[model samples]
Target: METGVHPARQPGCHPAHNPRGKPKRPTGRTDGPSRKIEVRALAEELGATLIRAVRRDADDELASVGTGHGPVTISWYAFALEYLDMRWPQIAAKTRNETNAALCAITQVMLRDVRGRPNDELLRRALRDWAFVLPRPEPHAAPPDVRLALRWVARTSRPLTDLMDPAVMRAVMQALRLKQDGTVAAPETQRHKRMTFVNAVRYAIEQGMLDSDPIANINWRIAKTAKRVDPRVVANPAQVRSLLCAVSYVGSYRRARGRRLVGLFAGMYYAGLRPEEAVAVTLPDCVLPAEGWGRVILHVTRTQAGKKWTDTGQLHDERGLKGRPPGETRPVPLPPGLVAIWRESIQTFGTASDGRLFFNERGGILAFSTYDTVWHEARQLGLPSDLVNTPLAARPYDLRHSALSTWLNAGVDPAEVAERAGNSVEVLMTKYAKCLYGRAAIANHRIQALLDEYD
Candidate 1:
């Protein structure tokens, strides 16, 4: 039924005129699809006065029922039912009154049938059974219907209304985990679903329905080591050098699969650039000098979130680096060799239509197929079997870890290294501390030299 305020009495009735009165109990029993009683009876039962509905704003057909708690009006409900009767394809205007009467049955449900069920369980059931599923058949979706279902479910879910509480939010969050199809099956998957569930719970609490927010208590702790796979396994320095030396800047061999792949990994390793960030580099972004090292300034990168699924193989939107508050840039210095590779790459494969450093033959964003194909060729040619089997050097970014660690082991100061690599000292130390094992004896010898001075 159409639901909205009635014209004659949009503000409802005043409590002073109604006073408190006990409702009249139903004396008769009728079966088969419960029907609404006369407005007088309902008004009396609800301790309200029946206001009649009228054709215009001041008309008389509209009715208002009064009560000590608030005014309970029936005119709008009757009008709404009439409106629904007309709108239904199968119902005739002659049946409008009856349909209106039936629509009013909802009052009984509101006042009696569902008054005390646990809100959370009800919301969970609604989400599981209907919410997204039921709306797919419709042309457009009504978020409110879904929200109301969720709200009602929350109201009925029991003593669990607060969102800030860790346990409560954890439970709610657990409900939104992404299923295999990429929609919210539970609370984790993509960031949006997690945030949505958290916000919904927070909304319930803010509305004064719950006492606390359960999510506030969650501890966002890191439970695993952050090291990239070792690059030595993928390609050692000597192997990398050999791979780069084999490619030329011209002809079919220049366009041969491994040239770009070699340049890609070498750039990632020596420049310490993330794949998305590295892919955004253009001919203009590369600054090379004739005799020494140069720099590659990464002005854009692609990151995905609610707008795109990670499994879709979509490109990250062009944007500044992660954690760089908008407007800032991340610049990585290029070793002389990598600069040489990029110069050759540009001469071989012309810049993408948009001046991007990399693209497919059609000038579209480079696809994973191209990347993987190039990588496989470079892998077989540039890496040994034992190192290839190990995890440390399994992927492109691992080369970055290798480069960063190599610099650190060469005795680069942590602060200088971190700044050059677009990382903080804390991250630098955490990720490559183990790589420093090879330099431990050298450090120990220095410590001994200091001790000798004391002696």
Candidate 2:
């Protein structure tokens, strides 16, 4: 009789089948060939049915899910893209970039652990440089390898439902706390990432993807961070004057490049203006009297956050003074020394095309790199070797700290100092508390006077 097994299923297909003869059965089996064939077909049919049922169930689960704003059937990658689209237009460029970074960090752990994984470094680059910057026009096409890696990630990323798991949330927090080298991130960086994650989770809740923020349920401890200014970095009055004099000597061949910044640096030392605010100061903003104290009305500040993080694609972003609302101005009184310095600078160098008191040779806004280089050289020239290695006025920003500390130590009211420095009184007292030298001595003197009366 002819067998039901096809000729294609002969000896070569299985060791049990003989090419020259009928197929052989196991020695212990008594079942007939037809019965075995029926059983095999039935098993195959059941497997197919089971697979189809599983796929159907998955589809149903996805369909039933909804984010408060819309459906939650999308993968994490898709959801992140949608979130960026909604937020891109409403936030500042720096904020957008920071959010992108945080999301990229979160995405690192929001993937399924699948086979054929890409190199970690390549995958990280793809997420940070391409996937996260969703709204920005890509400057160049990704390489073939990067494209392939990103495609793999997109395909294997977990769905939004997976984020509800406490384990997944833990993974995200852990990822944010680590650097690329697997070391702990800096405290400030960790804090920023945590804030970003918290905001994103809150957005998820709003959309109805999550019922609540998982971060709130977890107890996470960040490394201790120092918020106070170090007194060691503060420069004394004599040292500041010496540094200013040295600034005029830097790049002496470049038509007094250093000299142009002397007044700018002096403004930071005298008026407690941030470097950005001082750079944004204009002729109209200043009311420099002939001999007495003058005033500077600071309504705006120009901060450099790089072209990529600025909407105008310029190096600096002009915004309202830090922590202040637009159109609000802070009037900082300039000491007589700064008034003289400002008047002399205007008389000698005139103003930029826009009336900015400070500018480069082309009458453009001063480049941060140029001023930083000038400061480095001046520090070397002005500070003695021992002090040079120390933290005394180590950075341009230190000048502002030094100025604020000087004001506090001079017994200036905390509220008045806060107004001049564009900071809250609490911040002034907390951050500069350590920098207020001689306060302990004064307190001790008062205590001694009380003791003498008792004696």
Candidate 3:
């Protein structure tokens, strides 16, 4: 028997429409998979009229055998908008962008059918740039092509109920694992996207749409992200000094392009400060003196989260320290050399309008590109040709890594290192475990000294 929607009125009709008063209930088990044609699917086949038929006939067996109807629908696209609106105020700008990126990728799979779908590129832009963001543009006000793409997504987005199907979740997994171009995303990227999806579905469960987290049921394993810092990027103190010296030679003397960042990068090397943390340092945060050592009371990170994503309307987001709550502070000891650099930076370049120690000549937050370009040039000038092409201090962040590793190799207590570096001990040990081996020669020397005394 060919089992599909029928062209003519089927056997399982109620008394209202059929000349036959009411058809007898079908004999087979109603719970079986073959028994139901979901009213939405039936509506697709028979047009809107089938919905009225499903609603009018409340007979469970007959309706189950013909059109399975339950309730009115909320498309996933609209629900996702609502989900985002609820979450907007609470999260930081970076987190908001990250969540949106995850959801934007998942949107490709959440769509119902591709019938009459607009261009893939157009659809993606409409969703990512507008629909996923908190304040969506009015449908009419959107660009003509964007309006069409948004409308298509609105029309064809699958209902929240459809997630009960395991196959739907498998598609979501594929979306998380792959980029829009169908290439594999990085392992950390995959993990981050999955985390966002898990949170979204948890919201669905809270709304009573899902019985449990579908992610809990799925067995998909993403690739493991490396926690350890790459040893190739680590540079010794002497190399770092040479790189800092080289930064001075970049750009004209008046421009002072590379000169502005020497103190900032040195903070990363000597204090194990993240670039963002270094950027946020102010006069109040520093305890520089004509002394042996100083301390920087770190409290915040000023990193770019883009104007589109942030509530502040500024391109840079002034956010609390990573892994620490707002208003909490970390105090890092600064060597006398770094203290002199700080003093000089304050006296020569002066502070930004906000009192931050480092800023562009225009008195704006330093653009990442300026520092990155300067650092690349500095590497070329300062390092030998063999090392310039290598991974050694390739990123300015690697200076912080060098600081942490140097501290670890110097036999500093791991707990103290973790506290100074603003990391948990477990994480610090895991990340710098390979770098810790450099201290073995010193340990051997001490052991040899003891053995010689015994001899």
Candidate 4:
């Protein structure tokens, strides 16, 4: 058995029936030092002879199992925690948040009884934000009620063996599938949850607690996940330009809340930068010369995973590039219009102490709520009545879709677009660059002396 996971037979299984079927080092040899114990008095009571004493100590069965730390005695919550503890150092902050969320959903249904349970919402908060994650900021300082809720959970949570029961597994499946409102979860979310749960079950099997993985024995399928960006959400250039114009009008000229984000939005629309990448852009990353195409070399992303999950205890964490290695950079060509915008932005806003091009009024990282409100207002203000009701420019990220699809529609080479967009050529062609239907066809109309000739 792996170290620290006490070898246990839940109910039906033995060490010999361990999932790996590699015989456990005959009992007490696994966790710590083993020693010989003569059982002459006990053997005499059982009418056994002394001739078997000459056999190797390794051949003897363990006199007793682990003291209270075995699977039968451990709660499912504790087992799941141990699984996460083993995995913590191997995963990123965002992944840790995701794992915490998945386990929270699974844990809600892992209770022994609800006889004296606390409010469901409060219990979930205690699990999701505090108890499930470690290195938490001042863990002992959790609010009194939250501490009480956690204690209640530890007292009422079912044994790890309950996770193997078919009925409990079905409840777990249901909890993972539907939200509290009874709506089906997103496919990717459901898949993440199942993957986390399966890993926990496999941990049990690895510790010689189970004959097989319960999740593997069950029949279940996650709904299909989407790979390609929806073509409908990809805004074209004209709509994006109008939206940028409207965004500038969002707040009073003095506050400049909406005006501050104009250049930020332009980067995504003109250069295909992701929202997180655009937020982290610093003055040093840009090169805006007098006339021609400028350049922006990308390095990091400042993204949100909540203060509790982030190592910095801030709403956002600055991390390495999404799919690229540390310090690897992607260079994107900037248009002359964007260069002019950048020059104006630097003069007007002056940048944060760290040279970030855009920030909140207090010169801090931009919150999602702030930008989302700005974008929602811009859609209403910029789009035509009919178009506003549609999905055009629905999200700030769609400006990037607008940029990349415009490149593809304008017949740019796939490899070149991929390089500029920081995507593999396959992803550029299949996911990011789906051509919009109307942009090219309605671009212009010619005037002729005879209208029939044009038709």
Model with the higher TM-score, candidate 3 or 4: 3
**Tens digits of per-residue lDDT for model 3, 1-455:** 78786745565454656576866656764654454666557657887677656434422221122111245555666667767877888888988888898888877789877687887788788888877876665555778778666666766778766776789988888889988788999999898888888888888778766667777667899999999999989999999999999998888889999888889999999999999898889998789999799999999999888887888778889899999999999999999999999898888898988889999888988778878999999999999998999999999999999999999998899999999999999999999888876677877999999999989
Error of 1 at 43 (Å): 29
What is candidate 4's lDDT per residue for 1-455, written digit by digit as tens?
A: 55664446443357556678665466545342233233555666555444344222212211112223444566676666677778777766777888898888888899777676888889888887777887743535888778667766766677777767888888898888877567998999888888877887877788766567777656888889977878888776777888889999998999998899999999998999998899999999889898999999899998877886777789987888889988888888999999998889889988999999989999999888888899999899998998887777788888888888888777788799889988889887778534634344544332333565876
Q: What lDDT would candidate 2 get against the real structure?
A: 0.83
Compare the candidates by TM-score and give the number of the best one.
Answer: 3
For model 4, the local distance difference test gives 0.78
Worst ten-residue run, lDDT, model 2?
58-67
Q: Estimate the overall C-alpha local distance difference test score of candidate 3.
A: 0.83
Number of the candidate with higher lDDT, 1 or 3: 3
RMSD, every candidate, angstroms: 17.8, 9.2, 13.7, 17.9
Tell me the deviation in Å of residue 454 in model 1.
9.7
Model 4 TM-score, 2 decimals: 0.77
Rate residue 145 of model 2 by lDDT: 67
Give lDDT tens digits, candidate 2, residues 158-189: 87767778888888889889877889889988
Q: Flag clash pairs in model 3.
A: none
Give the TM-score of each candidate.
Answer: 0.56, 0.81, 0.82, 0.77
